[model samples]
Target: MSQHQILSTEPKPFVKWAGGKRQLIQTIDRHIPVQFGTYFEPFLGGGAVLLHLLGKNPEMKCRVSDLNSDLVLSYVTIRDRVEELITSLQTHAKNYHKNPDSYYYGVRESEPKSQIEKVSRLLFLNRTCFNGLYRVNSKGKFNVPLGRYSNPNIVNEENLLSVSRVLQSKKIQIICRDFAAVLSDAKKGDFVYFDPPYQPVSKTASFTSYTNKDFTYEDLANLVDVSEKLSDKDCKVLHSNSNSKEVRDLFSKEWKIVEVAANRSINSDSTKRTGQKELLIKNY
Candidate 1:
């Protein structure tokens, strides 16, 4: 499809990522720099902000990365092998419908070897899994149980197509790497958005296991250092994190911190999902 056609379809995040910015896009939109050079997103979660920016400027150059190799592969597969990935998803959907209970667990336990199958399995599990979460155990195994959905949209072909086309742009480069690596490439005038796994507000609220490795306090410290360097280089840096004392303490007074209301939809307790506040820190 043409680039204009792809942009018109409004390509969105293909997976339901934890800490996804879809809900906070309106507030985030207000904070984005009006003009910038290359875009950098080291902690690309659901990529809501990336897609939002791309939709507004399809030609925008973006460099996005994540530590999760499987998630990164999904983006590449959708961009290069979307048709095959869709076909594989159709098969998964067929079998999942036949016996959700058995098939869901079976796929969860069974890891596929092929790239397309791997991406398909991840998408299938994300769609039918509890709260659409992408959590992994200490051993890097997906452990989220099946969610109760009478009818889940397993095969969102149109959105996938849109996502695929938008990703096909040569200006967009997806990589699997540590978040701090952005320091190597980010330059002055670039816009860098950091949506890292948030510092938990409480002991029970911690859910940073997007991979087998939990995002530690040490990682948060590294993020602070990186943000500081990026700020020194004059790069437009915007960050999101839970409104916690630890997070607030790390960022200095120079960074503009805005407290925005957010919903914690991934929380098991529905009552606690609302009335959450998140910090949006930016250096203009």
Candidate 2:
């Protein structure tokens, strides 16, 4: 089918993600072109946008990557063995609901014997973890405590099958590496979307690190440099970050940066948590 025709299909994901961009789908769709060579997402967190795009434009080629190996492994597992992963998740849910603390930390503490087992444990922990947050210590362990939710959806079988179908059609590339490295393969006419760790707008609001490693100032600058080079080569770029002054200053030259409001989730106080502005840098 033609690209325009394919885009008419409704897109949806089967997972509940903490920082998922379901609300921003329309906003992103408005900025993105109707046609592009390939869609590249370097920081593939929940993959809400990627799944949406795949469903909307099944004919479009796409690539997704993440710095977190476990996250990548889960996605790859879902793509390759959706049934197996779903079964494992169902088994976990059955046992977890019985003994919340024990099962929660059991998956957290148990060492996976294989890749699928690793993926299963990761997904189980992610669903039951506090606030659906993906955080790890320096020792590379799942540390998020069990949440209050009694019955979290563990097996998103339909969505997993959809993702797998999308993978089968196009030359979809999945990588687990630094975001900068993905730019090496980017060429003119390619579309790249970056959603990095939020450079905290305030010191107190910083949380949700996927690993002990923090995204440094150098990483942000390197991203800007790569985006600039991509723009020079006529590759469309869009990046989402906190609307901090430092971030604005860095991309002010090349990007058409706009401040858009979003909620701050790093804090525990519900009353203090409200809408705050964030920057969306684009070179279209």
Candidate 3:
């Protein structure tokens, strides 16, 4: 298919990410370098921005990574073995539609042996689980209870197909590594976008439980140092984090910081979810 055709039917994020940039796409797009070298996204959560870039320039060179190995495996499976995945998801959707309650928790407890089964289980849990929030217990097992949706979209074939196509056609590198480690190959002229787990908005407002591990203040400091080094090497850097005094203090005056309103997906109270401020920092 032509790039224009794909662009017309652009593939969006398949998962409901906690810190997803779907709502902030236009705002972040405005800051992307008009023309640049390879693209690097160390914290590739949900990959909303990466999809936007692929839509704009199908041949764009990109390297995307995440700390979540299961998430990375899902991305690779979708890209390389989407047909098999679709078949697997179809079975999940049918069974889920038949018995939402029993099937949901059963699969949650049951472990799958194959890669396809594992990816399918994760995707199914993501779609049907509470708020689509990916959280793990201290034992590193998914523990979110099943959501109360009457009809969850367990088989999102369209978005999955489009995402698979984009991954197959584009010059993209998908890896399972630490953010800083995957960033080692970054060179001058490359544009690195960081969208790590946001700095906590309040004492108990952290959403970093995507993995068993948490992104502490020390990691944030390390990320800031990495971003600065990348900037010094002449790489265009753009990052997104919670709008907080500590986050603001992490970056120097050389980087431009812009505040934008984003809705918090995890909030139960609808009124409390809106108008939450997030910071977008860039070194142009």
Candidate 4:
């Protein structure tokens, strides 16, 4: 297929993730630089921003990474072995429909060693888990309970195909690595976006267990330091974090910090889900 035809579908994120930027795309887009070199996203959760940017700039070189190995593997599988992955998901969907509770827990408990099965398991759990939230226990296990969706779209074949096409580009590179690794490859004029798990505003709001290790205050501090170093290298940096005084204090006065209104859909209390603010830290 022609490049234009491939990019026309505009694939959305296949998995629902905590702190996904899908709802905040409009606000995030406003802060993006007019032009840049390779695009780097170290915290590619749901990849709402990366996919959105790719849809607009089809040929833009992108280097995205995530600490979650399974999540990173899913991107590679969808890009390379999409048909096989789809078939696996179809089987999962069929079995899940037979008995949602039993199948979900069974799949969650079984640690499939193969790549295809591992990614398939991750996708199945994410789709069926409570609120589509990806959380792990201290022992690094998928612990979220089954969600209450009457009918969930487990096999998103179309979106997966579109994602595969977009990701097949030679310019797009996905890897599993730490966020700080970008400092070695990112040069001047490149755009680096950091959407790390937001620091909790209160004790009750802490939910940064994307992996076994929670994104602690020290990680946030290190992230701030990394952003500062990226700025020194002349790269354009944009960051997303909760609107908290601690976050504001960590980022120095040199960074342009703007508070944008955002909704918190992960909150169990529907009343607490709306009217929240997030900070958009940038260095032009």
Cα lDDT listed for each candidate: 0.92, 0.76, 0.88, 0.92
Over all chains combined, what TM-score does candidate 4 have? 0.96
What's the best-to-worst order under TM-score? 1, 4, 3, 2
TM-scores, all models, native as reference = 0.97, 0.90, 0.96, 0.96
lDDT of 1 by residue, 1-284 (tens): 57566457888888999899999999999999999999999988789999988888889999999999999999999999999999999999999899999999999999799999999999999999988999888888899999999988887888999988788889999999999899989999999999999899999988888887888989999999999999999999999999999999999999999999998797888998899999999988
**How well is each residue in 1-284 modelled by candidate 2, as lDDT tens digits?**
45444345444554445455776777777777676898899988888788778776667787789887877877787768877887888899889878988878878889978887888887777778887776777777767788888678776555556665666664787889888876778888999999888776778766546767878778789888888888888898999888787788888575798776666564568777677667788986
Ranked by TM-score, the better of candidates 3 and 4 is: 4
Cα distance off (Å), candidate 3, residue 141: 1.1
> How far in Å is the alpha carbon of 228 misplaced in model 2?
1.0
Per-residue lDDT of 27 in model 1: 91
Off by over 4 Å in 3: 1-8
lDDT of 4: 0.92
- Tell how far residue 41 is off in model 2, in angstroms: 0.9
- Measured with C-alpha atoms, the lDDT of residue 172 in candidate 2 is 84
- Candidate 2 has a TM-score of 0.90
> Model 2 residue 196 lDDT?
88
The residue-level lDDT of candidate 4 at 86 comes to 90
Off by over 4 Å in 2: 1-19, 264-266
lDDT of 3 by residue, 137-221 (tens): 8899999999999788888887888899889965889998888874578888999999999888888787788888899999999
